[model samples]
Structure formats: structure tokens, C-alpha cells
Target: MRYAQVFYISIYLLAVSFKDVLCIVDPVSLSIGAGVGLGALYGFNFMKDQTYCRVTECCNERSIPGNIGNLRDMLQKRLYGQHIVKQQLISALEAHFNPRISSRKPLVMSFHGTPGTGKNFVAEMIAEALYEKGTKSRFVHKYMGRLDFSVEKNVHIYNQRIYRDVVEGITECPRSLFIFDEVDKMPPGVFESLASLVDYNALPNKLDGSKAIFIFLSNLAGVQISDQLAKMLKNGELRENIKLSAFEQILEKASYNLDGGLKKAGLIEQHVIDHYIPFLPLEKKHVYQCTSAEFMKWERYPHKQVIEAMLQEVITYDRAHGLFSTSGCKTIEKKVATEVWIEKQSV
Candidate 1:
């Protein structure tokens, strides 16, 4: 809309110049020349800028709008064994995405727990909740710690790329979601590039980090969280009684004392991170629920006896007579499939 006037004036000037050169041209010839020239100039400017989204698939201010109810339902339905993470994440997102009372800071959340405990899964759920295309959305960017910053020698190079990509992403969509997987193995210096991006006052080049969200997934603190859950259960506390407060101090201390992700980074001291969510280990009931869900996903009937048999044969317990699955819900689908394959072969 803003460029329409300029385009029209330029076309008028081109037509006048063409008329001066083609003074003896017929009326039809003049019209054709002017029309073609206008088209040519429009195409040139369109290509020169090259940033315009000709199609409607591009993400703009309204593309990745999130529904808090949808997010809550997704967490409650899909994510199992971590009541604390689901509630904390939902509450934190509500606060961050709230336009009326937002703190004007990027929502920085770190997910800590055992692998397969739904750290990455929850991140994907968040993307799906916010985006039409889910993780495939252009507004969603994921960086693998091992693949993106494998070598410590390239810390400087990684720093530049990290800053450039994050800045570009935030500039494009303020509601962008950036997920960093396996951050436990990420180089400490890598956090340096991201420190300011999560800050409330991060205004490099006037880019607002407040509208974006950053998620870091790590297996760090998994043992501590699991141990705490086990102790709480042993003390006769109901699983539903488990709350964020029980693990909040534990997570804070883990971030400082344990060799967790961003442990050496002082984001905690700067009070940049909004939440440190802990994913609990999967218990018998949660694992059974996951197995049932996986079977349903594969269009297989979730038989009670079959599920019990598979869990018995495949799942590794925390200890003798332990209630928790050491590996959480990580490989439930694979285990289910293998059990089905074996049963088919035997039959």
C-alpha cells in the first residue's frame, strides 16, 4: 500500500520519457510500451528488495498466535509423568504471552530431566500450540548442541552464527520460539551469545526480545529430580501433591552446583530465566498411559494384558521393585512395535 504511489509516479515518468522518444508512435503502441515498462519496473523493485512474501505462508504478527487453553490441554493430554513441568510451563507462557501484564522480557525456560522424559516433546507441543504448522513453522527454530556447536575451537564462529540467526529470527517474528536440544553438552561460551537475547532489556539494534520465547532442553539434573520425586513418594506424598515449589529450589541449586546446562553461565544471577522446569521420571501408571497412547497412535488396540507383558519385558526399573521407569517414556513406541512383531512372528 505504501509503495503504490511511488510505483504509479515512476510509471508516469517512464511513460513520459517513452513518449518523448516515440513521438511518432501510435496511441496503441504508446499504451503497450507504458504497460510493459511499468511491469518491468515493478518486477525489478520486487526482486531487488527480494524480501517480500508473495505467498501467504509467511509468518507475520498474527501467524503464530497461541491459545492458552490449547496449550494447557496439549500438555495435560500428551505429556505424562510431569505435572510440575506442564503446570509451570503453562503458567509461565500465560504470563509471557499476556499483553496486558507482560514483563517485556523474553520467556526463557530450561527443561531439565532424564532423556525421553518429554523435554523435547513438550517443546514440540509448545510449537504446535503456538503455530499452525507446528515445528515445521518458520517461526520455530531448533539448534542441536552437538551438531551446531560440536567443537570448542569454533566457539567464536558459533557465537557469530548464533547471534546472527537469533537476531534475524527475533526481527522476523517477535513471537518466535527457539529450542536448544542437548544443552547439557553445549559449550558454556555458547550461552554468552544467548544471554542478552533472554534479557528483559536486550535491545541490540532496538530488537525486542520480550516477544520471543527461548527453550533449552537438557538431561542435566535428571538424577536429582528423580531422586527427589522418589524420596517424596517414599515419604507418602501423593504424586498430585508434587508441586513446582518442591523442585524449584532444587533446580536453582542444580543450575549452580551441579554440572547442568548453562551452569557456568550467570543467567540465573542476572535473573533472566523465567522458569526452570523439571520433568519427572515415568512411573508405572504413566508408562502404561504412554504405552496405551503409543498403541493408539499406531492404530493398534491397547490390550491390557499385552501392555503389561511388554512393560515387564522391556522397561528398566530404577531398582529392584522400583516404581519408576529409568528411561521414562522415551522408547515406548519402539518397545511396543517390537513386542507386536514378536507376537506376530510367534503366531
Candidate 2:
């Protein structure tokens, strides 16, 4: 509204200058002509302002409505396994979106796990649920750590570029979601550039990002996280008993010990990130569930024997220690596709 008023005044001044130029040629009718011209300009601006407000109001009312229950239901239906991960994410999102919390910072969630454990899958699901176009939305920006910071010598340039891009994104759409995949590959200074946006303190330039969400996906602490979970399971602790808080310290320590940029950038040390959600390594059972889900997606329901045969095609590692998917469910679809093709050929 303030901007509209400023624009109106600027255009009126331009009209006044043109009126003065015309007055020199027709001095006798200057007052009458000036009054009519200015009145018409004012009337046009008033109508424009009203139309702008009406359009903005209609757009706001048409936006998708979301709540905690809707988010949880979507997660449960789309994501398999990682029950704890889903719960923590829901709680964090609920807190971030609560209207009563005025001092809220941008929601920064770090997903630490191996590939194919649904880290990226969960991120995409959240985007789809929150925004109308899902990941395809212009408001949802994705950055690859490796590609953005590939040259170590140009870290300083990349850092500035990252800061500008993020600030501009939030400026355009305050509710934007920024996903950083393979965060472990980012340079130290590059990731640190985003600290200001994530911090609770208001940015110096007044770029309010409290309504935005920043999701970091990394494979840095996967092994240590899995080891901790395995140890808990061996100690007669139920799988459900393991919570994020229980291994928060261990995960932090392992993340810091690693050579990744996450620790080097001081994100964990500074406590800039809100939630550190650990995605436990998927077991054979979970993989089977993933396989089944993929088949269902293709609308092809194979018999149990065929499903078992498809599972056999996916190679697992370290049977002597404890079996886990080599690449998680990342390649399950491709393997399933091949097996399905082979089965059809045999028939």
C-alpha cells in the first residue's frame, strides 16, 4: 500500500511537468486544463489501486490450506518406514507454522542418512504437500552442493553468489523452500554464507525468512548413525525406542569428526540448524516394502514368487555383520524394472 502511494505521487509529478510545458503555449486556459488533467490522473490511479487490492485478495484466498494432520497423513501414505523421522518432521513443521510464535527463525532441518533411505523422497513430499506445484514450483529452489562449490579456489565467489541467490529468493517469495542436496560436498565458507538466514536474529538488511524452510540433505553421518542404531537394537532396545534425542550427541560428534563441510562450516557447532533427523539404514524388510510400493506405482501386481525373484536381483552387502541395502532403495526401481522385463520375456 505504501509503495502504491509513492508510485501515484511520482506519476502525478510527471503529469504536472507536462502540464507546465503545455501552459507556455496556451497561457489563457492553463488553470482549467491543468485541473482537468490532474483530476483524470488521480481518478485513474484510484481505480488502479482498487483493482490491485482485489486481485491480491482473491489470490490469497485461493492458496492451498495445510495443517499438521494433513502433513502427517501425507507422510504416512507416501513414505514407508522411518516412523520416527516422520514424527519429528511433523512436530518441527507444526512449530514453525504456528502463528503464535513471533520470534520464530527459518525452519532449518538437516536430514542425515545414506542414499535411498528416503531423505530426498521426504523432502520432495514436503514440497508437494506445502506448495501447489510441488518440486516443480518456481518457489522451490534446489541446489547441488557439488555443482555449486566444485572449484575450491572460487569458494569466496560462490559464497557471495549463494547469499545473493538465497536473499533474492526469499525476497521474491517469503514462503520459499530451499533444498541443499549432498551438503557434505559443499565448501566450508559456502555453506556458512547461509548462517544469517537461518539464525533467529533478523538480518541486517531486514530480509525476513522466518516463513521459509531450509532442508539440508547429506550422507556424511550415515555410518555412525547406523552403528548407533545397530548397537541400540543389539542391547534389547526396541527399534521404536530409538529417538533422535537419544543419538543427537553421537550424531553431532560423528558429523564434526568427518571431513565434510557441514562441520567445517560450523553449522552444527553454532546450532543454526533446528532439527537433526537421522534416517536409519533400511533393512531387508523395508526394502521389500519399497519394492512392493514401486510395483504398485507401476500398476503391476506380481505374485509373491515374482516379488521374491525381483528382490533377489537387488544385491545386499555385509551379510556376516548385518544385512542392509547397498544403495538403500535408490536403485530398487531400476532393478525391479529389469526383473519385470525379464519375467515378461520368459512368459
Candidate 3:
């Protein structure tokens, strides 16, 4: 709209100039000459500025708008924390995409955490950041729980398919991101099988050397629960002879009490407490509650004020519930080893 207005104003100025020239020369000749001059000026300016090519596709060497740097810039803009995750991601990118290196590969990140702890939200932010910066990545959300990729054969098939699609997208567009959501739902084999791909040097390649970012978002709860369930079955506590109603009640109460203890310990945020599920490790008396610092790291990024407020909120909730004392939850602090990735410019 702004450009159109400018163009129209320029044309009007040209017409006024022609009118002035008309007072000195013939109207038809002046108008034609002014029009020709204006056209020539516009063409010269457009070509000289290369304004027509907002997004270049000339060659591999031609600069692409959203490349790896754009993605890094975007994530740095969105995420505010001095966590190892961000730094690790940055270092990995730098190493993998370094032109100095003889070969390059895609970056694969595995995000393992409890559900509702903002894993997917972070992934989306990072992906959108990459997109805004000019990289063409495929955000393939392979939700494990919703889909059937658990069997050994099925897991292999799924990984191969994902690998093929991601590679194709990256080759088509030099920089791309391929996200695999709910990866824990797949059999353990899938994770092990892609170990090479996850690592930098061993990235599988097609005829082209270009690569895409590979990411995995997996909920640790599912794997923990499955392991616990298997153990229970082996111990005969969850045998066929065991009553289903009794098991259900025990599971429910265990979950509630475990979640209550976590809240009482001030090791989890109120929102996390609300969404807590009782996995076996927490309920089976096998796992000790995490320290406040560890909990803060797992539950929230290492933002000082945010972690402090979260602990305070948990303490308040615990007090209201008449749960265990929240005395040790205080003095929770974080000493960051790496600089936070905060973009100085709009990503």
C-alpha cells in the first residue's frame, strides 16, 4: 500500500512537470518525453536495487533469507535463560554448520521431560523463529501416543519414513527443521537406532549434502510408567488374579499422594502440581524427591525470578493443604555457566 501511494505520487509529480514543460514546448511532445523519462527512472532504480528478488533462488551460493543463522537468531530472541539446553543447541549448530568443517550435518536435539512443562511450546517457538528468519523446515509432529509406532518393525518403518521426508525437505530447501513429537512412545529401539543421526558426524545423506534440524520431544512419564508397570507385573502385584478396582484405587491414591508430596516439598510449580500424574517411581517409594535446584531446572528454565516465584507459590499451596514443611525450599539459586541466548535484534 505504501509503495503504491509513492508510485502514484511520483506519477503525479511527473505529470505536473510535463504540464510545466508544456508551457515551453508542445503538449504532446512534453507528455511523451516526461512519461519516457519516468519509465526509464523506475526501471533503472528497480534493477539497480534488485528490489524484485525479495527471496532469492538463483543458486546454492545465493543467500537464502532464512538460513541456520536466522533460526539461531530467532531462538535467541524468544528464549530468555542461561540453561545448558540453549547453549548446547547453539554450540551444536555452530559445529554442525561451520563452513570451516569439511562436512556438515543436521542438528538433532532430544528434549526429554515431563508433560505440560512447555517442551512443545519451546519447539514451536523455535520452529516459528526459524521460519521468520527464512529457513524452510518441516515441523512434523509425530505424536507417539496418538499413533501406532510401537512395534519393532513399525518403529523402523516410521523412522525411515521420517528420515526420508526430512531429507527431501532439507535438500529441496537447504535449511529445514524436522521435529518428532512424542518420541518416547516409540519402542526404545527407535531411539537407539537413530543414535547416529542424532550425532553430528554420522548424519545420513542423500546425493546432496544439505541437511535439516532433527528434534525429538518425548515425555519421560510414559517410559517411566511402562517400566514400573512391567516391574509390578513381574512381582505379581499386578497379576491377573489381582482385582482391577483395587489396583485402580491404589494407583489413584498413590498418584495423588506423590503429587501432594512434590507440592509439599516445593519442588514443583502449582501449575505442574495441578497437572501431575503419579508415575511408578514417584509412587513406589523408589524415587527421592528432587532438590529445589534440580526441580527448578526440570520444571522451569533457570530464570531467577521465575524459579523463585514458582517455589513461593508451591510453598503457599503446601501450607494451605497442611502438607509437609517447606523450610528447605528456600535459597534455591542457579549459577549459569553459559551466557543466555537473548537476541539483541528482532528475530
TM-score of 3: 0.40
Order the candidates by lDDT, highest first: 1, 2, 3
lDDT of 2 at 316: 73
For 122-194, candidate 2 gives per-residue lDDT tens digits of: 8988887776667886778898888877677787897788788888888867777899898788656667677
lDDT of 1 by residue, 147-266 (tens): 887777777788788789899998877788899898877766677777766776775888877888888888888888888888888899998888887887787777766553477676
Across residues 196-245, which tens digit of lDDT does each residue of candidate 3 receive?
44344444554333345565565544333334444565676633333323
**TM-score per candidate, chains pooled:** 0.81, 0.80, 0.40
lDDT score at residue 276, model 2, on the 0-100 scale: 83
Which window of 10 residues has the lowest lDDT sum in candidate 3? 279-288
Error of 1 at 303 (Å): 2.9
Q: What's model 2's lDDT at 221?
A: 82
Off by over 4 Å in 1: 1-55, 339-347
Q: Point to the candidate with the largest TM-score.
A: 1
C-alpha lDDT (0 to 100) for residue 111 of candidate 1: 86
Off by over 4 Å in 3: 1-82, 133-145, 148-153, 156-160, 188-206, 221-347
Ten contiguous residues minimizing lDDT sum, candidate 1:
48-57
